[model samples]
Target: MEHTRFARFGMVCTVDHLASTAGLSMLDQGGSAADAAIAANAVLAVTAPHACGLGGDLFALVHEGGGAPQALNASGRSGSGADPGRLRAEGHDRMPFQRDIRSVPVPGCADGWMALHARYGRLPLAELFAPAIRYADEGFPASPLLAPAAAVLPGVDAALAPGDLIRRPGVARTLETLAADGRDGFYLGEFGKGLLALGRDGAAGGSGEGEYTEADLERVNADWVEPLRARAFGHDVWTIPPNSQGYLLLLALAIADRLDLPRDPSDPLWAHLLAEAARAAGHDRPDVLFEGASVDGVLASAAERRATIDPSRRARLRDLTSSGDTTYLCAVDSEGMGVSLIQSNAAGFGSMLFEPATGINLHNRGIGFSLVPGHPAEYGPGRRPPHTLAPALVTRPDGSLRAVLGTMGGDSQPQILLQVVARLLASGESPGQAIGAPRWRVGPGLTGFDAWSEPDEASLDVEQGAGWTEGLQERGHPVRGLPYGGAFGYAHLIDVRPDGVLAGAADPRALISSAAGR
Candidate 1:
């Protein structure tokens, strides 16, 4: 039976229940889905700071009244002083990934929220921020996910004893500023000052060398672009263009669209085809998908690569670090408008460089760029790095909204999304069933391998005791079982049905994941 619940007015799905509640409240107050998404994302910055916050980047696919999905790239660019030659002089072989200020970019999330709200919002910014502000000031309970992340914060209580309140007056002040002055409050006012001060101190503390001026902050702006489009499983898929790995999501789906894989979710062949599709995506990722690349060529290449993969053998895949360190959320309104959004601090706790005054943790997104001189994603002044944040939207043949979904899993983002989309489109799985079903990921067989190296062999990691694991092994595919809720992925989905009924689902793997609607 289908476990998904339908809503008439609106729906919100987020990694945290409080965020879902915050968004639903906005919808109840007659705000558009975009407005509700901002509300929920703001709350997430306060509650799930370990995963994402104001100091990170954002990518969104927003569908207005079932119209063509619009794409927003709010990703930050490298600092103007970011020179690859200087980095090599500093004795770094690859882009450094650490708890340092150098990894922090211009921070485009604040501007992202402003742009989204400005386009579709109905309520005042103050009303939208009230919920997050209240939580930061009055202190909500610490989440299970926050416990370990909080323990690492400097000079904070490592222990969250019973009855303890997670009060962050600093975060509250930032929200208050944003509510009043809009984007300027963040990029030019007090928040920007705090960021500059943090950088100065970061250099003084000797973590690493980083230089930033007021100009960098002022120049930060999110771009509105035509979404990269494709057809998969008979539905049109829309995602953000370059600087983000969204094209890879479409590439994987393109492969799936060509094959007649088994529809039975429990069959071993299903997992094999999914993993093979992911493997094909990785091989061509570095060559075809990047800034200014051709969408048609990328899709065509994906089709060619898909034909070469041997179904019974494991394909080479590098071990991308598995950090459950990003938040994805989606909201759809009664008007048939929808917003699918994903935001991140790069890794858990981001660069681990927190600004005490504003309670912000800067993202380590710079690590996404390459130090390799000839690499397409090599670091350069003011260049946007290859981003992993990808949000998605689906539309019917007539261009009506079908669903909005996304997940947080680094390079695993597209892989996880492909698996779920395949189930939804090919097997008739509901949002809940697709999200809650046992999952598998393809990558280097062993953990702790160098993320930058291509592994000589590949392994498929499946949920423990899943029948597909043994079935896959019989077909000569390397298989390993992982504990339930291990490093798989956390997905959130909102589906719009033919009759205009909307339903939402949140992955059960995340303890706080939830969906709320009237």
Candidate 2:
């Protein structure tokens, strides 16, 4: 197990060491938690482009000292020219898959940074972005995690080796522009032109047209909304509301909270119950999470579902789907401010629609939209796709911040978060112990199209050494052994003790993830 880093002043935990260092530097420079999180995320954009970048969506849960936590939904909407009808006529039944330009949405990462900075930042934009710009322009050593993924991008050397020095001049220039001109530097400037050009060139494979007008780009803004809350393990859990699959985490937790979960982490029955709860949440998500749907009813139904879980046999769901490539990080300042942030490109290299002018790899978030008419996530103009980026925060009953945590696992995100949170709260595990524990995910398949495609039954993917493996198998779970390191999600967490001490941990699944503070 990884050792937890403890600090009295501040803490920053992220999936990459360089990014974690960048965030720590921000905190040392007297920046707030928001500034630290944005700095870390910017570095991730430069270092881990396959998972997140300027061409992505972001969601966050922010909590200030003695104040209620707030949620930021910075996911972008589908273009005004989106057309589900044309896709249907072309014989498509679901959303377009990744790699197609039509699957790209208006990126909301830049706007998210701006919104976060506007509300809680103490440093200038240029200062917050300096580390990423320097790394992009002067070159940084390629990480083992990034080498193979970067090789797949256009123009990248296929034989790229870990530690090789790599530079992105165009991306550097774009970051410089963003630092100098704020959000306008991206959505209304040269970067925006390059995006429009790609659409006009009909680079959307054989699809009709990839139309993204200035309106779609210009109208992109982050919204600050009330976080959805659920009481579990004597603490209140908060997450980004609908449009984000975060509610799944809450739903699963609610069901588990109502059930007589075993306190032993090694208990096979515990993992089985959690997996069943996850399957139930995944099965019901599509039916309850569309635009204007009442999540209260769904959350209220958790108790009803809790009674159906059979300890002796796995509860099977009719259908389920899950997938994603993303990054999650957390930062905490001396003043009791915490930020749980998540960002993603939807899949590896996103839509793979790299814009030459800006060095931006556009995201395939639009792929989350459905093609079925009248569906909540149906492809349409000015609609935000159902997103998997779910960041979460927890507080004591008296409203004191307790923890800031999250992970990146696409549809498996909530399941991963559930494991970590349950360990941290219900089992009283330390941050390091909780984050380093073996994890399980409920999904249709392990990889490829089948991984994200809707399937008749869901499988439970458990880490190879999990003590409950045989138990889960005997309980009728479709148990699949996942090799340790990289198969599961990379989670980062900051546990706030009642004494104001911060304890943080970064998952070992990521090659260079770290937790640092001073």
Candidate 3:
């Protein structure tokens, strides 16, 4: 692939091959950490177009040198036509959410990167996306990941084109303009017209969707939000601003802190521990959250009171679709910078309404909008959906990056991320060992486990690539094991040693990469 033409590194790590090469090239050019991140994100919009794209949402937590970590939210907003009252009259209240055309929000992924660039980027936006721009204009081989998506849609290949030189020319051109002009160029220009035009013809029924006019896109702006944080073990754990499931990570970490990571996440007993934690933590989504809630500020303030233990129950309930199997990435650069980015289309394919114009798939976030009247996150004029895309970052004492990390798989994300953090910091594992380690996912309820190891319920441990499928089976949780590097929500990690050298690890299960420097 043209995007993979080369690789260089002062310090960088990424989830896609082309993305890594793009970022590494920036680092080699002496670009700052933010520049490399912007570069990597552009490539992801290209190659990993399945789960993420330029027309999507993005969340990042950045820590530059000795500075406190700052967050960036590039999530899209709703249109004026949306109305919460209309949705509730139709009766649709559940999570693990559903997929509908109404879920598509104005994409903020590109703008979000642009926002990050403006504050910390050293190179021009055009330079940051040069590789991706060339690939989109010139072309590159279709990645294996895109094959199924291609086949699923009739005429998607021809509509979007296929073969070695596959490219999203439309989105590429849109990105080119955004790179030159910043966030406004995309949301306010021809790009906005195209997005609105496409979304209007979509198949979902919700407000802010079905009929957004050019007036709406031209007038709408991406809002900047103060991300939420919760103190854990004396360290500050920062995550996405309100309207996202970030609290789940804080809840999971707190729950895990109660249990124990000193043992394996694959143990039968460990499975129960994780399941209980997930069940306990996941229940908060449907009942507690609403549109007006100040999820961020209040979460920490209410941490003492709101942080309730199901004193009687052993676990909590989790919604599957609203927070399901997903994808995530994390990285830190040579400048002592850290980034945690998580993007998704809601479901495996989102609205599954592939835009023939840009190869950009829309999000099913509207599925998360409540059908209940007076609900906070209901489909309405300018309301954000309850999101599962929360990426977490932790800073160690003395002002250095401790862990730059995140995971895929909805509710399972916080579950996996918390355990890995503990494994790396508490268990004394190296970054590689910590991330490459075997993983497990807690379930939606307090019933049986969704364990990937022994199902015997008595056996309590399994190793990586171990006959974990068998272990999970014997342990009573139907487990689907893959060839070692399975979809365990691989977390791209960079462990910042005291001297500042980074020991990096990209989940081998997924196509991830990393490089470090002094």
TM-score of 1: 0.93
* Model 2 Cα lDDT, one tens digit per residue, 422-459: 99999999999998889888753543223335533667
Off by over 4 Å in 1: 1-3, 161-163, 201-210, 287-289, 316-323, 444-452
The residue pairs that clash in candidate 2, if any, are: none
What would the per-residue lDDT of candidate 3 be over residues 68-110, giving only the tens digit for each residue? Answer: 6787766767666665555555665532243454556666676
Cα-based lDDT for every prediction: 0.79, 0.84, 0.60
The most accurate candidate by TM-score is: 2
> Residue 223 in model 1: shift from native, Å?
0.6
Candidate 3: 10-residue stretch with minimal lDDT: 1-10
RMSD of each: 3.4, 2.4, 6.1
Instruction: State TM-scores per candidate.
Output: 0.93, 0.96, 0.81
Between candidates 1 and 3, which one is better according to TM-score?
1
Residue 65 in candidate 3, Cα distance off native in Å: 2.7
Model 1: per-residue lDDT, tens digit, 1-518?
Answer: 24476798999999889999999999999999999999999999988888898989999888886568889999988766666876688788866676656667788899899889888889999999899999988887778778655766544567664335687788888999998987878878777887777666664232334455678888856989889887888899999888788887888898877776998988888888877777776654555445555566666676676775666766544432111468999999989899999999888888777776677888888777778887877877677887778899999989999999999887778888998899898999999988888888765322211222453355667886457977788767777787867377788999998888887898877887888988
Report the CA-based lDDT of candidate 1 relative to the real structure: 0.79
